[model samples]
Structures are given as C-alpha cells and as structure tokens.
Target: MPDEPAPITEHLGELRKRIFWILATLLVFSAIAFSFAEQIFLFLLEPVIAVMEDRGSKLQAISPTETFFTYLKAALLAGFMASLPVTFWHLWAFVSPGLYSQERRAVIPFVFASSLLFAGGAVFGYTQVFPLVFEFLSGFDTSGLIEQSWTMSLAFSTTARLFLAFGVAFELPVLIFFLAATGIVSARKLWSGTPYAVLGIFVTAAILTPPDFVSQVLLAIPMLVLYLLGVGVAWIFDPERRRERIQARDEESPGEPGSDSEDHSE
Candidate 1:
C-alpha cells in the first residue's frame, strides 16, 4: 500500500503541537530549577567561592533582594540549559522533512557533538576561566584605600554571560561542518583561512571576556583549536565527496583523441 501525503494544514497543526510541547517541557524544567534555586546558585558560584575562600575575601550582597533575584536568574539559566535538548530535538524534527537521508545522517553527529561541546565549554569556563577572572579582578584591590564588595546581581550576571559565551564559542566546529555540508564552503577553504579565523577568534574573545589579556587568551585559544578540529573533521567525514569531485573533474577533462570530453581546444 502507498503512503498518503499529509495536508499542509495538518503539517501546520503538528508543528504547532510540537512547539507547544517544547514550551511545556521548558516550563516544567524551569519550575523545577526554581524550586532548587539555592543549590543552582551555589553551583554557579562554586569557582568564585573557592577563589574567594583561598584569598580570604568575602562575596557580599549589597541589597537583600539581590540574593533572591540572583538565585532566580541562576534557576532560569539552569532551566534553559536543561531544556536545550528538548528544544533542539523539536527543531530537528520540524525541519527533518526538508532533508534527505544523507543530510539527516550528517546532521546526527553534528547535533550530538554540538551539545557535548557546549556543555564542555561551560564546564571549562566555570572551572578554569571563572576562577582566573575572579582572581585577577580581586587582585586589583588596595587593602586600606578601597573596599572590595561584589554585588550578587553583577557576579551572577557576569558568570551567566561568560558561561553562555563559552558554550556558543564551542559550537564553531558544528557551524563549520554545516557550512561545508551545505556547500557554502569547503574543508580546504576553511583550512586555508586559518589566519583570518585566528584573528576573528581573538576579536570575539576580547568582546566576550573581561577586559583582560589572560581571559581573552583563555577563550581564544580554545576557539582556535576547535576551528582547526572542525576542518579536520570535515575533511575526514567528506572524503568520499572529495573523491567524487576529483573523479568528475577527471571525467570532464579533455585528454586523449577518443575521450568522452568534447575538445574545444584553442
């Protein structure tokens, strides 16, 4: 028996339902995170806390409401991170109808890699970058002339921004892979553009990190390595495509007297 085609209206209805479900899943996670806001805040502030403890500095909240709102913000960020998989799956499913089997296969590795890379980047920022940044900022304080007090809102906001920035930066490889797969660019072109890519990564690092060379370098180095990794992965994964292109070029070449290529030699 032949399969029946879905109506446009039915497809639209299904899309709406999926969107609703994604939203519902996000909301559920958000509520759960909010319920555990204190723990989430502690988790987010772990690196800073450890650094502060080592230096005998206190992290203080200027206002009573600051702590409350900081926890709420932490919970929201946690919820967003937790719900990302559901959101991505819904998005993948929604657009899957437009892709062929090969395209779909290529997409699977990218999606999985992207999620893992993002999580790893976040962990890197939290464990390595955050402590270093906090230490650098804290070191600038004078004992008698100045007082060091970090606002809860400012601390949490900065942590969240850095975490998100690192996470997105780690997705560079996935972006490259998609560009290569879609023919917008090739692995060879990406490899050839290494200098420009390095410059761009440093620029992005300056923009995303605190106004310090150490933080900028920390972000830029990882991004540059990831870009190189992307080129290698694209080359290895698409070797068959490269071979086919080479074969096609050879077949189209005007070689011998009785070759398939029609000679318009001048």
Candidate 2:
C-alpha cells in the first residue's frame, strides 16, 4: 500500500522544527563571529579605507558605544552568511517530500550555487563597484575647505548593508530557475515582463549601489544578464512542457489506460 500523506499540522510542526534549528545555528555562528568581527569588517573594507586615506579622510568614532555596535552588526551579517549552507539544507529537506526523485537530487547543487552566487556578488561589489563609487565621491573635496570626517557607524553599516544587498540581488537567477522549475512561474510570463523587470532592476540597483550612475549601471547590467539567462533556463526546465511531453506520449500509447479500465470492468 502507498504511504499516507502527512497532515497540515504535521507539516507545520516540521516547519517549526526547521526554523528553530536555523535560528539556533545563526545564534551560535554570530557569537563566534563576534570574536573576529573587527578583522572581518577591516578585511571587507580594506579597499574603501585605502581610497579614504588618499582623500585624507578616515573612519571616525565620535561616540563611545559606536564601535561596539558596529562590530555587532558585522558579526550578525557574517553569521547569517556563514549559516547559509545549513539554512539551504533545511529548506530543501522541507520541500523535497513534494518533489520528484530527480528534483530531490538537485539539492546539493542548489545549496552550493546559492552560496557561491551570493559571495561572488559581494566580491564584485568589493573589487569593482566600491572603488569606483568611493573614488568618485572622494574626488569631490569642497575645494579643500572642510576636512572629511566620516563616522565609523555610518560607513561600516552602509557598506555592510550594501554588501548584503548585492549578495541577495545576485541570487535572482537561481531564484527564477527554481520557481520556473517548480511551475510557480513560466518563461512566457518572465519574457512579457522584461520591460518592467528592467525598470525594477535599475531601481533596485540604484538603491543598492552608491549614489553614482556608473555603480548603479554596473549592478543593473549583471542582473539584467542573469535575468535573461534565467529566462532561457526556465524555457528549458519548465515543468509544464515536461507534462505536455508526457501527455503527448500517453496519447500515442494505444492501450495503457484502456487496459486498466477493462480490468476494472471485469
């Protein structure tokens, strides 16, 4: 006999358990990250710090508690990123029951790709976008009248936020690929929404990158490319098409369904 499906209450309980483990993992990692938060932030901001030095500007701590809280924020961000593999695993574990065996086999690739894409985006922002945006901003020095005194809190927080934003934005392709594969979205719909997606992408890029056209375009272009790639992937893996193929094959099969009905009639 076939196994019975789990009830909604059982599903909810399973979800709660996964959420609990995810949160616990984050808390533990964040505590560990707190010990090395300063090192991590310094590493991430090394390039920007160099640009600021060139402009005779440096990150400053006016208030006593500002540095402490800044490190805390950095720790939290690091912990969230560090725990991504576990988070992805839990998410896959929850969803795999509803998927075909072949789909279930994709969990490893999904987790690896998601973590890599996020880190790659952050690296891109650090290597390419930050230097350009900061260099352009630092170029404007008010004709050397007032000295530039950037607050530590604002600088660290803003850069960290932008790093996370860039990382999240880079996951667009994987997200679309998953949704299209699962039949939640279709290639035709994504194609039709290209104009609006372009507008939204630019707007998002503007928000995520610094206030510079070049930086915004830098982010937007890659995202647009990824969006197009996702559409192509969606066309290939779309479950509806797979179902149609199965249906066509069934129609060509002469007696599979008829034999079942005839056996029932006897």
Candidate 3:
C-alpha cells in the first residue's frame, strides 16, 4: 500500500522546523549584509541622488538613530535577497510531502526558477519603476523653495519595501506551479478566479508602492503579466489536465479492463 498521509500535528512540526531553519538563514545572511550596508545604500541611492542633484535636494536624517536603523533594515533586505535559495528550498520542503515522486524530483528547477524570478523582479523595480518614481517625486522640488531634504530612513525604507514587494510578487508563477502540482489549484480554477485575483493584485500594488499612479500601475502591469504566466504554469503542471490526457490515451488504446486505473490507483 502507498504510505499514509502524515497527521496534522506532524505536518505542523515539519513546518515549525522549516521556519526555524529559514529564520536562521535570514540571520546569517543579514549579518553578512550588515558588513556591506553602506555599499548597498550608495548603490540604491544612485538613481534618486542623480535626480536630487538637479534641484539641490539632499537625503538627510532627522532622528539620531535613523541612519543606524535604516542600515539595519537595508542589511535585512539584502540578507533576505541573498537567502532566496534557502528560502525556496524550505518552501519546497514544506510542500514536497504532498507531491508525487515525479513532482518532488523537480526541486532544482523549482528553486532555480523561483530565485531567478525574484532577481528579475528586483531588477525591474530598480531599472524601470525606480527611475520613474524618483523622477516624478523629485520634480516637485524647486531650488527656489525652502531647502528640499528627504529623510534617509524614508528613502531606504521605501526602496526596501518596493524591492521586497516586487521580489515576492514575481514568485506568482512558482506558487501556481506548486499549487497545480499539489492539485490545490488548476488553470481552470485560476481562470475562474481571474477577476478577484486582479483586484487583489492592484490593491497589493497600491499598498506596496509609493502613492503615485505611475508607480502603482507600473507594478500592477507586470504582476498582471505574471498572472498570465502563472496561468500557463498552472496549465502545465495541473494534474487535472494530466489525468485527462492519460484517460484519453487509455481510451484510444483500449487497454485491458481496469488495468490502467488499477495501476494508477496503485
């Protein structure tokens, strides 16, 4: 007989262990990142600083602890990015118990795809969205007006938030793939839920991005694109689709009565 499913308590225990390891990885990477927080800050600021230069605007800190805290947050964000491989592995481990042996074998591809999507999201946000957001916000500062000073903490926090948000957003396809693999969600189901999913994506974009139409819309468009991509992922891994194909093949070949079903059931 096939092995029995694990009890809920065992599943919960497994989840707790995974979370502990993931947190440990985050801490390790965060420590590594803290050593180079200054470099990360300077790299992130390049776009905004260039825009700020035109208007003599400067990034400053109001509170004494702002810089320290910002650096800490930056380190955390960097650590989170660096730990994507560990994070993805934990995610796969958490779900793999429910997957068929064939599905479990795709771990390397799953981890690689998830990590690549995360990096792609961060790059898109920095390259395409960041410049537009910085340009629009910076345009308001006129050199003639009172000195334009942006808070160091605010800038860094916003950058980190958007980077993290984009990275998470880009994991949609991977999420769908696993859901399909586990028989939790199918492409047909996703299609039926499209309207609600879109509403949720836009709302998430509005929440995560700066309070600007361009920023929010920029985030939303790519997410919608990813949603389409995720639907494709769902279609490919969807067991319902696979079952249908198998049934069709069996019907065409007219295999021995109940043999295919028995083999599959076994």
Q: Higher-lDDT candidate among 2 and 3?
A: 3
lDDT of 1 by residue, 1-266 (tens): 22256789988997998899888887788889999999999889887777677766767888878888888898889888887777767776775666656677645665677778889899998888888888787788666577666766887887898899899899888888767766678788888899999999999999987678877898999999999999987886565577888999999986776554454442
Measured with C-alpha atoms, the lDDT of residue 210 in candidate 3 is: 74
TM-score of 1: 0.80
Model 1 regions more than 4 Å off: 1-22, 106-108, 142-144, 239-266
Error of 2 at 131 (Å): 1.1
* Model 1, position 129: C-alpha lDDT score: 87
Q: Write the per-residue lDDT of candidate 3 for residues 1-266, one digit (tens) a residue.
A: 22369899998999999999999999999999999998988787777777777776778889999999888888888898889899999998887776668877899999999999999999989888898888887666466566667888888877777787788889888888777778788899999999999999999999988788888998999999999899987888788999999989988986678998999999
Ten residues in sequence with the least summed lDDT for candidate 1: 257-266
lDDT of 3: 0.86
Name the candidate, 1 or 2, with the larger TM-score value: 2
RMSD to true structure for each model, in Å: 6.5, 4.7, 5.0
Candidate 3's displacement at residue 225, Å, is 0.7
Residue pairs whose backbone atoms clash in candidate 3 = none
Ranking by TM-score: 3, 2, 1
